[model samples]
Target chain A: MSITVAVDAMGGDVGLDVTIPASIRFLQDHPEHRLILVGDLPAIEARLSALSADARARIELVHATQVVGMDEPPQLALKNKKDSSMRVAINQVKEGRAQACVSAGNTGALMATARFVLKTLPGIDRPAIAKLMPTVKGTSCVLDLGANVDCTPEQLLQFGIMGAELVGSLTRRERPTVGLLNIGSEDIKGNETVKQAGELLRGSALNFYGNIEGDDIYRGTVDVVVCDGFTGNVALKTSEGLAHMVSVFLREEFTRTWWTRLCALAALPVLRHFKARVDTRRYNGASLLGLRGIVVKSHGGTDALGFRFALEQACEEVGSNVIGHIADQVALQLEKIQRPAVEPSTTPETL
Target chain B: MSITVAVDAMGGDVGLDVTIPASIRFLQDHPEHRLILVGDLPAIEARLSALSADARARIELVHATQVVGMDEPPQLALKNKKDSSMRVAINQVKEGRAQACVSAGNTGALMATARFVLKTLPGIDRPAIAKLMPTVKGTSCVLDLGANVDCTPEQLLQFGIMGAELVGSLTRRERPTVGLLNIGSEDIKGNETVKQAGELLRGSALNFYGNIEGDDIYRGTVDVVVCDGFTGNVALKTSEGLAHMVSVFLREEFTRTWWTRLCALAALPVLRHFKARVDTRRYNGASLLGLRGIVVKSHGGTDALGFRFALEQACEEVGSNVIGHIADQVALQLEKIQRPAVEPSTTPETL
Candidate 1:
């Protein structure tokens, strides 16, 4: 059976220009895959017309009149964006029309729509979004980049389980080590939520690596690092900012000294290869896990090539049977498992 | 008439090897300055003997028998470490015998001791640590980096004022913009702490840059970024890790192909220059602000040279008279300020 990736053709600015072509390119590169484009028939067609004739035949367009605005209120959009390409894309996966859905849209909206349309997987309390980050040694999977800002102890534990399963399937590691992102490596450091999360994670079968410090993220210390979206997002942003800052600084420093410039001349070959590994585009598409169907959220500002790269990643997710793998793990770890009695509250903690 | 920096000579591993030599270099470099090294006389004397004979006459040592262990609790250490190099260092500043104190020791103990000895300025309830992070545009100061984890509305407002003044002192920018790190650029999205702080910051005279997303840190969008210690520590660590990751990855990428290797050689000059700009050693000292005196804390793992850098930084802070400037500003901005009629409770509300 061939893999099918449903493209949300209406969300991002580059959706039409980039997603369609990238989808075509990915399909061409992987002949064992089928493509289903979900969006307005004509716009996608106009964009699709730009593709070479032979490649056009490999594409299939599923018309949907709705489009989820990239900036729509997440909650409100999920309720009303029933016909949106993002929702329709996920619906295709649910209907077995596609293997997974891919979109570069408002993160919250996509997550909300995914939860609403496809529903969370069995034994899953809430869904999480995991983004692949390029680390020093290899790639690190960072979860809850922006799924739920306020998660419970159980939710965090679920994230750890979910993240472990996802990384296990997608990466070379079979049983990836999971880390709880906290202020300190010691047990006494994190807030109450993290402390409780640690105890719960410690009990799970997933390879719990205990507490990991913020500085450990890029050190390639663990395969997976888990945190709520608020902290995770900040961490992600800080990383990006620092990366940019450092490179800029290095450029300035080397150019100032003629001798260092000579050293730079000899080091160029190794440096470019290293730069590619850390480039943000290398790990662009984020997996939307725990939802009923596979949905990938790519950066909204991605270019045509970036969109294509995301499409390639989506294909990898489909080809690897990653979702099925996660579902299996989720079944073993949580599906039939008895849940402890606990209060589920949505009120914010007063601090 | 002379600038004196109290050296916590008993602190860290290198002690005077790093401390004494750096101070000697500074005094040699600046003949206008004076030094009062505070620590055990015997150890300092043993280390001082190694210094050049000419440099010995310019230095002064004050004996203080106690030393604060890195593992000691902040409160207990402050109470018991009367003879600690940290205590004596701050005390020297308190007695107006020294203009600043520099230590590579237990940070919490140093903070507590400094606070205890120096006392908070009249309007300030707590002091903050300001770390100057290298940015695309030279550098930016991030305040409250692990000094205080959780902040109140009034406290955040004070941080903004404090951070603003610190930035002004370094960059001399009038009305330097202060950005409050948050989930989104919009003021509506953050937690209650951020929102309440935003309300307070907006009301204050300091230039409020509104919400700054995490990516803004490297963008050099603001002069000062203010957040509680918990978040600040996360940001700082994340940045450090990312920089390391980037350097490592660039090394890997540049070696993948001969052509890439050639590219690496070509880019070597640029990359080396980048390292110097982002080098943490250039910006390692964390200036203890809002204390009665200038107390700079160096990273505990620092080596002799790093200790020397901290010493140089301390001398600069003293010469700059940053503490006195902040003290004056606190008096001017806060003395006549009207505090809110209602006291905010510290109890966290569970939703």
Candidate 2:
């Protein structure tokens, strides 16, 4: 099955320098995929002039007169930059011209523009930013990274459902286990919203793993970790800060003297292997789940290689039909809740 | 002046094994300090039989008949375990027999009992847990780790003041910069409570650095980083998880094969130095701030070295008169807010 993805070519810190190259590389690697590059025509063409005919045949260009600034406010971007590259890219997804959209623009602006254009899935009050994080056993999907600072218990339940569906589709897992993020693992922990969310999750159709602490994210104790955006964002950013600091500390120790530098040279291969095991670029894309169409947000500061990983992520979501799965799951859950007289033996099996 | 700290000898995972030796080491190191060991007489005597005469002279044994289980609920521990080592240790502070208390018991029980015994300072609503985290520049003090799940705007302002006072007294920095932790550094970021807290911090006499993201905690952008307990707890635990994962990855890479093992041996010294730089044991103690008396909670799973560090922390707090400083700071801020006619030039100087 062929998938088409719209790229915000004029977005991110380096604009065309990263996006254009990333798009060309993705097209070359994915023969069954096509891309619509949305940006300034002259600028995009300048970078793509060296592409082969086969790659050019798989690519389309859409002109956008404006570009959203990396630090622009979300509300202003949504209201004023209607013709921006980010907006045009999302429009392709809304109009069915592309199955998914990929952007490395300002996160707030991307979320606002995409939500404005594509709307949200039915029964989902708000869209959440879900991202894959590296864990000891494997990767865990955590949601609401920074989309909504304050989340209702119902919204958290929706996030759990959407997260389970996303994981199920991507990994072909029949029933992914979901865990509510809390300060403690016990039932009587966290704020009122989280406690209420835990009860809702326990009674839902999804496989609810009890409450999990922050350390459980790296432990890979559950497939899906759900929390309010404020907590999730803080956890994610704190991890990044810690990882950076450790690397800096390692560098300082490795170069303290000539003998230590020599030892570092001898251990270079092992260090490189360790770095590859926890590379952030491999997990560059964050999906805006619960949206009507698939939209993946790349890290704004990433290079072409990292942006290519994001494009690949978009293609994977499109091919797996994640949106349909989420919609079906939501409807099924609602039906189960509404039908009060249904017996346990007569209930339908979960997906 | 000699400062005496009450030690809960039957707390933590290792119980008497860790606390007794740690207390003996602490007493040997600080001749001007003393310890009141509270636990079962037989168990406490068994460990202290090997201590020197000089060390024994500075130590006092106060037998407590009961013990608080590590997993016991806070309310139950507070009500049922009246003569528990944890409770008895806290009572020493209440009865003015000890200047401060150190415990490695259940955090909830420690907080509940400490608050019940010491009560809160005049202008403080609740006690917050503040601990020092290593950062790129030096170290940043953050609070409240998990005391209150839901905090009001006024409570957050109180936390900022408490955090500023803690850092100021500990580092002797007269005026420490305080940063409100949020998802973004912009004034428009975070939830309503955080936004209001930011406004309050800015208007106060603190060296208010408007707002900081999670990364700022590690970057040491400010001396004191303040947040609601839920967010702070998640951030702290997430850092622990990430650091653990990285170390595990490094070990796997180093022991992958004989060649890698050889490289690891060659780089052992540099690796040890790196490990010591980011040692969690060195930063073991967490201060329960805003209470009328001093209390430090150690990690439940720590060894003798870590518990000794907690003892050192309690002694430092007692010597610095942290409670008095916090009370003074809170009162001064309250007075400034109440007297609306005080001009900026006529305002009293902050501690």
**Number of the top DockQ candidate:** 2
Best by lDDT: 2
CA-lDDT, candidates in order: 0.78, 0.92
Listed in order, the DockQ scores are: 0.51, 0.80
**Model 2 bad stretches (over 4 Å):** A338-351, B340-351
* RMSD per model, one decimal: 5.5, 4.9
* lDDT (tens digit, per residue) of candidate 2 on B232-300: 999998898888899899999999999999999999999999999899999999999999899999999
TM-score of 2: 0.96
Candidate 1 lDDT tens digits, A13-42: 656877776776786777767788999998
**Predicted model with the maximum TM-score:** 2
**Residue-wise C-alpha lDDT for candidate 1, range B231-347, written one tens digit per residue:** 788888887787666666666677767877786777665665565556677787888888777888988777656666776777767666666777776776564345443345556
TM-scores vs. true structure, each candidate:
0.89, 0.96
- Model 1 CAPRI rating: medium
